[model samples]
Target: MISALTIENYRGFKNFSMNKVKRINLIVGGNNIGKTSVLEAIMLIISKGDPQTIWKIISGRGEIVNYVGIPQGVIQPEISVRHLFHGHEVKLGSAFKISAIMTQANKSIDVDFKIIEAKQVDQILYASLPSEGMDTFGPKIALSITRSDKKNPLLLSIPLSSQGTLKQNTLQTLVNINFQQFPNEDERAVFQYIPTTSLTGQELISMWNAVALTAEEKRVVEALQSLDDNIEQVAAISSPVIFPQFGQKTGFIVKMRDLEKPVPIGSLGEGTWRMLVLAIALVKSKDAILLIDEIDIGLHFRALSSMWEMIVAASNRLNVQVFATTHNNDCIKSLAMLKESEISIQRIESFDGPAIYYSADEIRVAATRNIEVR
Candidate 1:
């Protein structure tokens, strides 16, 4: 799991840091407070220096520049991650290059790069850099695209801001999965990002059907049902992946035990669909990092606490590290309830300038005082 992350000069954030992270990290902030930017920074770091991968991370979800085009000044988007790579503690940071020539603005942004040894295990993390003086902090070579007969560049490319180098196909597949595994046909056509290794068609159905409905699932479902008396019982579907039927306008599928039939998931209610998505995401994201933006979306305030209980269980059971963002006070309260030795909460708050993080205890205090740091 990544214990810490830092990002600089990316979108709304000048600098952001999260430290002392646990298995499950929750980010809470108001709109435009750079909550999603943190996730984008992580995706960029993991993708290495691939141009296409960088574009995917920055362009989607309205992160890209608008009609005015790319920003003129320095584009020093940097990200750092502290995690166990191959069971050894390591820190990785990546920076991208931006030129002054993009606009008439005096963007004398000479890139710098360097590498150095660190003193702490998960702290004081830095990336390995080339020998070139200050310009070795990231990849020495900046990527750019040029037409066959043109002398100048056609597109200025910002390389992947990941820790180390990764294969193009490997990085693409990872990005595809990060966005979502259940992209519709049209979504796939634009950017499929799906790996051939991922389960498909009947394979997905078979896997869901074969799931034993373990004790953990039972516990989770019971907790979910407790939130709503209307819910009779929640059961896993054994046939056909339960997903949004795009053309039908239903956001999910529900298999009711009474009728013993599949029904439109939207008819059930938003809370049910949210729980089901979390459940499926937990199961599918084993041994991987799951990034959830605005996790409180479409969730009922009363059910927020129960949803977090299941989230904690999923993280523990699946070896998955969850990084979710929320602006809801109830959501933060639910996270505060999770204070075991194994589970922890890290609250990221953005102030006037840099973003700071608080541990589980600090967050509790802040929440108690009715502070609005985000």
Candidate 2:
């Protein structure tokens, strides 16, 4: 678990540090106060500066722009890196660094991102260039990623198109290479990120398949039962219809105790789907880290306590560290009920100021005193 997190020159933060981070930390703040950016920073560090993760973070925010390919007419999407920095503009020496101190190891993991001008010494970094234009690979700009645990830094030359953006294909190739080198999933830590909109049907099906026949599946079913006691079993199945637009081509269906026929999980309501997704994600993230944005979404206020209860129980059993953001006071107060779980509340004032962290005792005091933690 990360005991402390420090961000420098990252999105919306010039220099920020938050200490006393517990196993389950809830981040609260006003709109555009960089609540989600904190999650992104943690994702980057946990990924060990993987280019694929960087592409996902930037592209998810619609920061990509279209450019004509090397073969001339074909269009390709390029991820803009400027938005990732503090000033939202990329200069010759722009950089950002994120570091965290692990409580178990008592050591820090660091991920640094820097923009440097490409030189002759950087020619060896052009291993994943486009096939057609191998000779014209003289890029003026390059993004250098350095990790504390890694001996050598990853240098990716930025293509000279629309403010020197990174090509999606380039990052994908790097990701493939990384996967080939590290093929086994158990060799690395599991990292799962749930967004405000929750997991899509395809994502949910894939996650369910990961824990389908294992003991984790039972936990998922129990989580759903918290919302609806009638939920007896859950399974992911392929739809008879071929097209997804017409209907869900593949999704989860639930067997109810009262009903004879299996019903689509979506038919039950958004709360059930949300609970199912959360449970599956938690199970899949055993012995790892789970980052959730807007965790209180798609659920009634009545179910907030149950949701936190399930989260606390699963995270404790699985040894998973969870960092979630929320604006709901009920969701914040619910943490006080789970006394056994190590909880922390991080409140962000603004980009110009530091974040305030409250310990488990402080959280209980705030809840008892009816203080506005949000």
Candidate 3:
């Protein structure tokens, strides 16, 4: 588990630190206070500065610029690296670093991202460039991951276009090459990030397939039962080829205790789907980390406590560390019902300001006093 985390020159933060990180840490703050950025930073660190993950973070926010008049076969989206820095301007040496102290190892893990000249990278990486005679002498984005136990850092870089932005296809080619060269880079830990809207139909199908017929699948069913006790079994069925549109949108069907036939998971409501996503994510991230943004999106206030309980129990049993953000008061108060040692809350006021951390006891007191932490 992370005992503490520090973010410097990343997204909305110039310099920020959160202490007393526990097994399950809930982040609370006002809108646009960089709550979600914190999750992205953690994801970057866990992924060891993966280029594809970086692009996902940028494109997820609609930060990419679409270009027209490009050749028919060429990718047209471009992502600016400047938006990732604190000042939103990328100059030589401009960099951001995310570091955390692991309680179990009593050591720190750091991932540094910086802008550098393209010439500094190996020429072999440029072989996949387009044949349109695009210049490869411009600046590039470089990433380096350092661990306390390792002697050398793991390095990766992607070239930038003459416009000083990352082209979609260029990045994809570089990522493909690097994956083949270093296939086991992500063997360290399993990291899963659940966005605000939750997982999609295909995403849920993939996750369900990973744990099907295993003990983890049982946990997922139990989580669904929290929303509806009659939920007996859950399965991901193939989308019908003849009438794909008529099939379950999420490709999941549930067998109810009293019902004669299986019902589409979408028929159960948003809460059921949200619970399923959370449960599958927790199980899939066993012995690793799970990050969720706007965790209370679709559930009723009455179910928030049960949701937290399930999260706490599954995280403890699976040895997974969870960091979730929420603005719901019911979600904040729900933590008070859990053991104080197992949870913590971090509150942010602004991007460049200090973070206020509350331990489990402090959270319990705040809940008892009806204080507004969110």
Inter-residue clash pairs, candidate 2: none
Regarding lDDT, does 1 or 2 come out ahead? 2
- Give the TM-score (vs. native) of candidate 1: 0.56
TM-score per prediction, in order, is 0.56, 0.90, 0.89
lDDT of each: 0.47, 0.80, 0.79
Q: For model 3, what is the C-alpha lDDT against the true structure?
A: 0.79
Instruction: Judging by TM-score, tell me the better candidate of 1 and 3.
Output: 3
Off by over 4 Å in 1: 49-55, 62-252, 257-262, 341-354, 367-373
Could you give me the TM-score of model 2 versus the true structure?
0.90
Candidate 2 lDDT for residue 110: 90
Is 1 or 3 the stronger prediction by lDDT?
A: 3
Runs in model 2 deviating more than 4 A are 67-75, 121-128, 131-139, 153-162, 175-189, 238-250
Model 3 Cα shift for residue 121 (angstroms):
4.8
Model 3 residue 251 distance off true place after TM-score fit, in angstroms: 0.8
